[model samples]
Target: MASLLAAVVSAVVLALSSMLSERHCAFGFGGFQCNDPVAGYGSVLLTATLASFAILIVSALIATWKLVAWFRAR
Candidate 1:
């Protein structure tokens, strides 16, 4: 259940970042490169990327823990 929730949240985060990139740059987020960004664009993008990573890491950790627990129970 936790893993599923994490997956959903991570998807949402990525979508939001993509939308933000579209708004700020002519190129999309997948390009991963933006030239002549407005003031503070870099910082905002960095923060969003970091947050997405953090959520994914946590989700992985949770899933791993659950799997280990299940194995031990068996």
Candidate 2:
């Protein structure tokens, strides 16, 4: 339950960050909107979300495998 909840929260956080960053990009200006914080943030959020999910899945898999091994050994 807790793990599921964490995943849900992670997804939400990433989505929100992406959204806010997108807004910043749309409004911020430079020659080519080069001064935008939104575009950068959106990229960052995408990267972070990808990394976070990979880490979560790897850790969860390892933990579950360990648990099964532990119980089997007992």
Candidate 3:
């Protein structure tokens, strides 16, 4: 259950980070564009996404371990 919760949280964070990274604004006339400085194409976003994936993997492993243990116990 804990691992499942962690996986869900990480998935949410990954989705939010991906959305923030893609956020942009367009200007009129000149057709200029602006992106969020914090989340725009950079290492920060990449790191966040990677971290989330790592957490997800860890959670999945934990869940699998618990499942296997349960099956063995029964």
- Which structure among the candidates has the greatest lDDT? 3
When superposed on Cα atoms, how far off is each prediction in RMSD? Answer: 5.6, 6.0, 6.0
Q: What is the lDDT of every predicted structure here?
A: 0.71, 0.57, 0.75
Q: Which stretches of candidate 1 lie over 4 Å from their true place?
A: 15-41
lDDT for each residue of candidate 3 in 1-74, tens digit (9 for 90 to 100): 99989999999988876676556434447443346565234456666778998998999899899999999999
Model 2, 12-59: lDDT tens digits are 766765565455643334322313544445446556657766656765
Per-residue CA lDDT of model 1 for 1-74, tens digit only, reads 77968867886886787676666655456544555655347556756867887887888788888989999999
Going through the candidates in the order shown, the clash numbers are 0, 1, 0
For candidate 3, what is the lDDT? 0.75
Q: After aligning candidate 3 to the native by TM-score, how far in Å is the CA of 3 from where it should be? A: 1.5
User: TM-scores of the models, in the given order?
Assistant: 0.52, 0.49, 0.65
What lDDT, from 0 to 1, does candidate 2 have?
0.57
The residue-level lDDT of candidate 3 at 1 comes to 92
Question: Which candidate leads in TM-score?
Answer: 3
